[model samples]
Target: MLDTVGLTVAEGEVYRLLLVTESASAEEISGSCELDTAAARRLLLALEAKGLAYPVEDSPGWFAAIPPEVALVPRLQRQSEALEQTRAAVLEMVQTYQRGARARVGGEAIEIISGAAALRQRLRQLQDGSRREMLWFCKAGYVAMPPESNQEQFAAHDRGVLYRVLYEQAYFDDPGSVDNVVEGVRAGEAARAVPRLPLRMAVSDRSVAVLPLASPGAPGSPRELKAALVRESSLLEGLIDLFERYWEVGAPLRVTEEGRIGGAGPEDAASLVPEDRHLLSLMVAGLTDEAIAGQLRVSKRTVQRRVQGLMSLAGVATRMQLGWHAARRNWL
Candidate 1:
């Protein structure tokens, strides 16, 4: 609309009239519009000032519109440029304000989100805003979101968000939890496992962190569940550091070609098939033979037989010696 170029509604009508005619006098403008002659003349002068209209060469009181390409286009371009500049400036100011606000209320930076629903919602929000990476400490027990149920992590990972997840050994005790880990790894998540974790936490891009205020498995109703949403604070940095420290000591997890859990092993174990690697990884993670059999859907005897075979292949006389051989030989 001509209003964007600084024309009033009546002045825009006058401009359009001039555009469609060779030239128009104030009387012609007033007859074609709601404005009177004096008002129409004033509008025409205003348009002239904006370089959208000019006096006809041989006529004293007639005006014609400047070619639209010569007038409106440049004005529109200038307006667009100004708007972009203003937007950038406003964004800068907003960032400055957020920084200062966080500084002024350091104690308020950690928000205590209550209830299972609120915790789940906050976790999703943090994942959605993650840009570079997401770090997680996955402990055992059902929380607001179980690992298999966290679809947001997959969505973020698919969009190139790096996911570094550390899982406690008990996490795999959950039925289908290993398969879920395998699925995540195949989908580009970098996963590892330790015997235990201190707590459950998720950090987004290292800028914000969310951790449970109480143990998830504590006997309590959903309404009693609580978590802390920490932002840009020393506490957040410490949480990130904790995650990294655990990740360094954790055994890397992998998936077999058959879509089962596997693990890193020495080059000597490369000759072992996917199933063997899968078995070794679970064993190294401290899963009992019964637990390993359940995960692989095999009998406990079958698991023992496989262990015996691995030990025989390593020429070891005992399980402890086999573990040593597996590590020294990089067979598991």
Candidate 2:
């Protein structure tokens, strides 16, 4: 099939199974082809639509396969026509956009782009063109701040782009933070950490904001950090509002006592004179004993002892119960 009609391996397997099985239902084909039933059904429908498979009208959910030689010609012809139609539609869209862009950019303009290299080039242009600051809130472990050395970040920083980044607390513990710090120091970028962030984001000078799309490989792949950028100031303002809210609650990124990035807050340290209220606050914030120790530069045993003392003070058997009691009393 690959040599004759360029069918993919999975497609060929499904086609062969249908051909050999006479008249099989989607479930049967799925079982024979080692695919999910729904997925098999979709493929079978596609094959039928392309004339490679014909539905058996008398049989409730059965399909008959057409021989490859008989099926390939019509299928390929249909595909070719579909591709030509798509190409024309795309070309018309490009022309329409170009005209709109030209009219809008009479002096300065915004451009929409697709494809990897084009997107990268646009990002580089934006970063290079930025005069003031670049602000970002990123997922804990995913985005390697400053990306690679030779990437757009370093180049933008070289051109004097001040960067302020907020990261999730977990990211500090990730191996990627080392690269983050190395590139950050080299680029003179400032960064902070928060325990958790709502979503991934990047904004530049209130002129452009990038937000992640939820779909897989949406704007692009997660590793690619694909995002949609809006140049509209009103929309950018809304994004900035959200960014500031998360920034206010986020922690500063610091090397922990354990020599890792990020830890609990200062109020969580057992070495500090324990204020029952402060300890309760830390607990409510979800800091573990180890995190508390790292934050306070105390032994984890000390944190455990303090927690136990606090638990006994509250007359609670479990932390959740203790937290509930505290919350009920408005302690946190």
lDDT of 1 by residue, 143-176 (tens): 7987777899889987899999988878777777
Number of clashing pairs, model 1? 1
TM-score of each: 0.62, 0.44
Model 2 C-alpha lDDT per residue in residues 286-322, reported as the tens digit of each score: 4667665755577889877877886787789987666
Candidate 1: which pairs clash? 266-330
Model 2 misplaced regions, further than 4 Å: 1-97, 100-119, 141-146, 182-187, 215-226, 255-332
Best candidate per lDDT, number?
1
Question: Which stretch of 10 consecutive residues in model 1 shows the poorest summed lDDT?
Answer: 98-107
Report the CA-based lDDT of candidate 1 relative to the real structure.
0.81
In model 2, what are the clashing residue pairs, if there are any?
A: none
Worst 10 residues of 2 by lDDT: 102-111
Each candidate's lDDT (Cα)? 0.81, 0.63
Off by over 4 Å in 1: 1-106, 263-276, 285-287, 294-298, 305-332
